[model samples]
Target: MAVPLLGEHLLFTLRSPRLPTHAGQVSFPGGVVEPGEGVVEAALREAEEEVGLKGVEPLGFLSPTYSPQGFLVQPVVVFREDLPPLKPNPEEVAEILLAPLGELLEVEPWSEVRLGRIVWHFPWRGVDIWGVTGNILKAFLEVWREGKSPPHELL
Candidate 1:
C-alpha cells in the first residue's frame, strides 16, 4: 500500500531581526545552492541546515527558475516522514511559521503592500512575502489551480 501524502505544503516564515538579503519578510526555507549540489539536494540541504529538517524525501522537482540575483533556482517539492519539531538556526531562521497550502490556494489575491523599494503583500501574516521565493510559491499555486502545468518562468 502506498503511504498517503499530505496535500498541504508547509509554508514557513523565517524569523530573523537582521535582514540578510531579503530580511524582515516572510519566505520559504531555502537559500543559495551550494557547490556541486543539484536543486533538490540544495533545497533539502538548506532545509536541514536552516530548519533542522533531516532526511526529507523529495517527491519531485517543479522547474528551474532564475532568481533576481541571476542564479538559477530549482524548487524541490518534498515530504518529511516525521517533521521533527523545528529548531531554527538563529543565523538563518528565527521562527518557523506553518502555512497550509489549502489556505494559500483559497486566499484572495493578496492586498498589495509597499515596503521600501518593493511591492507585495502580507496577506497571510502582517509580513510581506515577496521576492523570488514568493514567486515560486505563486507559480506553484497557479499550477495547482489550473490543473495543468505552467512554465516556471511565467511567475
Candidate 2:
C-alpha cells in the first residue's frame, strides 16, 4: 500500500549508515515488534521514533515478510493525514528522503542485478535495496500494477 501526496504517491526513507546489519542502506523506517507490541503498534511507533511523523492513520495490515536476519516484519500500511515535518534521530536514522511512489513504480528506471537464487538487485543510490525489504516492495508494487495481490508466502 502507498500514501497519497500532491496527486501522487509518496514513500518515506530511512537513511541508515555505519551499522552492522544494513549499514549505509536506505530503507523504510521500521523494525521488528517489541515483546508486547503488536505489528500495527510497532509500525507506527517505529515510524514516529525513527522519523518524527505524527498522526499516522494505519489503513490495514499487509503481508508479513521475513528477514534473513531473523525478523518477521509485518508491513503495516498507513496514511498520514496531518503528518508533521520529519525530524530523524541521528542515532537510528541519518537522513529521511521522500520519493514519489509513481516514480518508483516505473520498473524501467530500475535495474535488477541478480546476486543469488533469491538475491536480485534493485539499486537506488549507492545502496542496494534488496532482500526482505526489497521483496516486500516488489510484491507491493506488483499488487499496485496488476490491481490484484500477489500470492505472498507467510513469514
Candidate 3:
C-alpha cells in the first residue's frame, strides 16, 4: 500500500460505489503485488495506476499490516514536494481525499468490536476511515508521534 504524503498531508481514496467489493470505502492506493515485484515497487505501481500519481519518491517501509481477509499488507511510505493534479480512475476510485497529518493526530478514533479484535475509525469529511486503512494510519501516526520511523525529511 502507498501511504503518500503530499507535503504536510496524507492522501487517501474513496472507492467507487459501483465496485463489487469494498465499494465506497476509504483506502490507500494498493493492490496485490504482482509476481516477482518487490513490495515497494508494487505500491508505487498501484498508486500510479489507481490515482494517476507519478514520480513520487518512496521514503521507506512501514510495518506490515494484517487485514481481516487473512493477508498481510506491506506498506510503503511515499512523499511529494507538492501535490500534483490527481486523477482518480473512475472504475476504482470515486474521490481523492487529503488530510493534514496534524489534524489526524489530534482527532480521537472510535472503535468497533465486530471484527473479533478492536478496529478503529478516524472521521474525516463525514466518512469513516476504518478497517485496514485506519489501522495503517493509526500505526503511522504513532510512529510519527514518537519522532521517528517516517525519516527526518518528513519532519
Return the TM-score for each candidate structure. 0.73, 0.75, 0.92
Instruction: After superposing candidate 2 on the true structure, give the runs of residues whose Cα lies further than 4 Å from its correct spot.
Output: 1-7, 81-83, 108-117, 125-127, 148-155
List pairs with backbone clashes in candidate 3: none
The global C-alpha lDDT for each of the candidates, from Candidate 1 onward, is: 0.59, 0.60, 0.87
Q: What ranking of all candidate models by TM-score puts the best one first?
A: 3, 2, 1
Local error of candidate 2 at residue 73 (angstroms):
1.7
- lDDT tens per residue, model 1, 65-89: 6655655667776665444566788
Better of 1 and 2 by lDDT: 2
> Which candidate number would show the highest TM-score if scored against the true structure?
3
- Write one digit per residue (lDDT tens) for candidate 3, span 6-55: 87889999999999989999999999999999988999999999999988
lDDT of prediction 2 = 0.60
Worst 10 residues of 2 by lDDT: 1-10
lDDT string for model 2 (22-56, tens) is: 76566777876789978777777888888777676
Better candidate by TM-score, 1 or 2: 2
Candidate 1 colliding pairs = 15-94, 15-95
lDDT of 3: 0.87
